[model samples]
Target: MELSFLSSPQIFFTVFTLAVSVFLYIFIYHQTNRRKTNYPPGNFGWPIIGETYEFLYGNSEKFIGDRMKKYSPKVFKTKVYGEPTAVLCGVAGHKFITANEEKLFRVWRPHSLQKLFRAPFLPNASASIPRETMVNVTRAPGFIKTEALIGYLGKMDTMIQQHFNLHWEGKQKVQAYELMHRMTATLSSRFFLGFEENDPRIEKFARLSDGMTVGLHSFPINIPGTVFYRAKKAADAMRMEVQQLIMEKRAAMSSGIQTQDILSHMILSSNPAAGRFKSEKEIATLSSALVVSGFTTPATALAIIMKYLAERPDIYDKIRAEQMEISSSKKLGELLNWEDIQKMKYTWHTSLEVMRIIPPFQGGFREALRDFTYEGYTIPKGWKVYWSVTTTNKNPECFPEPEKLSPTRFETPPPYTFVPFGGGLRVCPGKEYSRLVMLIFLHNLVKKFKWEVLAPNENMIGTVIPMPGKGFPILLQPLST
Candidate 1:
């Protein structure tokens, strides 16, 4: 039978509508089945978005605390952009994930710009930078022959001496955080890419890269006049600069010249299978990552450390004595080495305590991959899980008198209770490096100058990292030789 022209349109519309209806029904059914059977209860805030709005605007910490009190240490389920999430609180919950980390915890894929910023060109860029690569580059070593811990110590000492001369010369009063950021940027560039002081690109890259932390939580839309847009522009400019450096390094390598920077190491090292080393893009991206990860944490920690010292004059005196003991036998302009830092165990402990109290990445999120049962609640697959390192550190049971700033508590605190560097396979690879930086800076600061907080009553604000609103200024007095 011949079909009428009008009837053909009617049939197509009816079939399309029917297909859509069936698809909708199936999707709804699947989502309904995927819903938690008896998941840990918590507020979802608004529909679909769940607690994302609260999280984005800085209420997540308080929200998590409130839920912990009401729900009592369980997996609190919620959603972000319609994605399911679970937040594990209390000692048991923390232990469960850390113990079975490989299975229970996964690095929630970092936001897109993270992947773009890490390795921009790959189609599957999100997955392109392997966990193994990150572990190797950020941590110690793998098939690639980056320096181990001791090598890091040597470099750190040299960098510390240079930084001291640049910023802390003759007891000048400086903004601790500002000096720290500049020093770290310079030191990291010198250590990572072997850039000289005259390399203007380092300062530009630092400016752009620092803004990236702000971009991570911003809306994904890169429309003109947006923060993300500016970040992307900055990233592109940095990338171009890196490309130029890579070409220069490659040419230098071709001529059999070996430089002492990370770029030279990357160029010379080969993959186990005899493949040429990491691409210039990869090197540049990784170089940027190293700087981004290292710069802020140490700078923020140094600021906080200064704040604590300023508040407690007694502790300041004790630390000063310790520095003097280390420096008493050494001459001016002599570099303090790794062995010297190791002698300042008390300083290390104090820094550790400060981090526990104020972790840089305060709360981390992970998404569930499969249905999981916890405390009579079934957390279905695809739920985003948040673990608050800050709040957990404050738990009274785990840390007696948790609010008090006591470094000695770490000498014997309940195991797994204080994870400022996070836990699991994803724990920060730069932990030891950060430790060395903080110890070295504190050692010198205490020895050279007496400092007191300019505004002890100023409130600290929380962002991706926490810092005092008034920028931790201190009145500095030079010590007599």
Candidate 2:
């Protein structure tokens, strides 16, 4: 009654051979599929898993660079997060993505991000608010205008001065990263929702925002007790709190209140295209998002700028001299104006140079609107596209002596080589806000304290936003002006 002679004596061997063959077949199929399609040169790695593990845990630069070396340098195909992605490298990639928004591509928030925004526990108001919706509201009024920005300078200067007066002055040592993060986070609460400097709610807002940010760039492992789960819960609480604030602001405005914060502005401003004021829900959505996302970049920039200042005293002295010159012209207690900011060119340049060497965000991802061809390779419709900043930011041809920490490179940067805030209609309006905060913080810093980096070669982690490994402790002393 045996199926065959071998089947009777070698059941284990037969089953083992079948499993290995199936595994090899799947591997070979995925590997060979690149050639099978009109796709770009590169393998998709193993089936199901793909190159995702390496993409997450391995070196980001090397991940792209290794493939570029082995395959065509222009474009390559790979799978990450269970999606086929086409990575476009260098300035050409930057130009193409920047120019082609809504034409051939669009902003592609990860499913995880979308899920975070629309969690079940959160209110349904945000469900209708797309990323583009926020952009439209940004153009409506407030925050994005130069007049509004100029008006904010004094408040920022005062806020930062007070921040340092309490947090920095007389402190023997501090974690530079934590210090900057606290400053920026508090600034976001005050600017966006008009929270007072010493409000207990500011602390609550910062803690909740930190919780929400934990899963923005992480995977969607939404189990009962995962980080993502906690992030979702934090988002719910944050949205509820912001909605309550919006309700209060609306009532105050109705009764002839005249306050000047981003929330009040949004409450009164109308979307010109729609010719109506943004709904309370819409205003709440934008305010909550700004509070959560606004502080991160400026905070990171300040921390890195300070780290570099400690490492290079010559740069520090140069920046300090510029700040001193500006201060000399101003009366004591006078806030920094647009004119003073313009004069801090070298200081701004230093920040740019630091950004070039270590960009805050590597780049953003986009989804193909339609099938497109670039560099003789086909990028299929519905595929994900990642336009990298690291590729162009570090390009030697674009930046001669790219590795050098030279702020003067910005005096005549190569055309379209580095755009820290992105370009075109897709450009983030928050960039101006970040610029003002970082420069104002620097102005206060150079005028106030000289710090020492406790751990110069401290290992940094995180591919997008690198942070010190062991710790980022620094010793501070007030400068005897």
| lDDT of every predicted structure (CA atoms) | 0.68, 0.79
lDDT of 1 at 254: 92
lDDT of 1 by residue, 1-481 (tens): 9757668789899999999997887677546645734667765555445566666656545767877778656667666545667777877776777775658556664454454465543446654344556666543433123335456565566666677776677654566666787777776777667788657776776787666656656555577987777766766666677768889988988988877765566656635354323467667776666666667768777887788778778777777888889888788767677678778877777777777766666666666767778887877776767677756677777777876878788677676777767676766776666776778778777777887677778765655566567766667787764
Give stretches of model 2 more than 4 Å off. Answer: 1-32, 119-129, 265-283
Report clashes for each candidate as comma-separated counts. Answer: 5, 0
How does model 1 score by TM-score?
A: 0.84
lDDT of 1 at 374: 80
Q: Give all candidate RMSDs, comma-separated.
A: 6.1, 5.0
Clashing pairs in 1: 38-377, 84-383, 84-384, 85-384, 86-384
lDDT of 2 by residue, 249-330 (tens): 8788889888777777777664646633345554665677778768977776777788888989999999999999999998
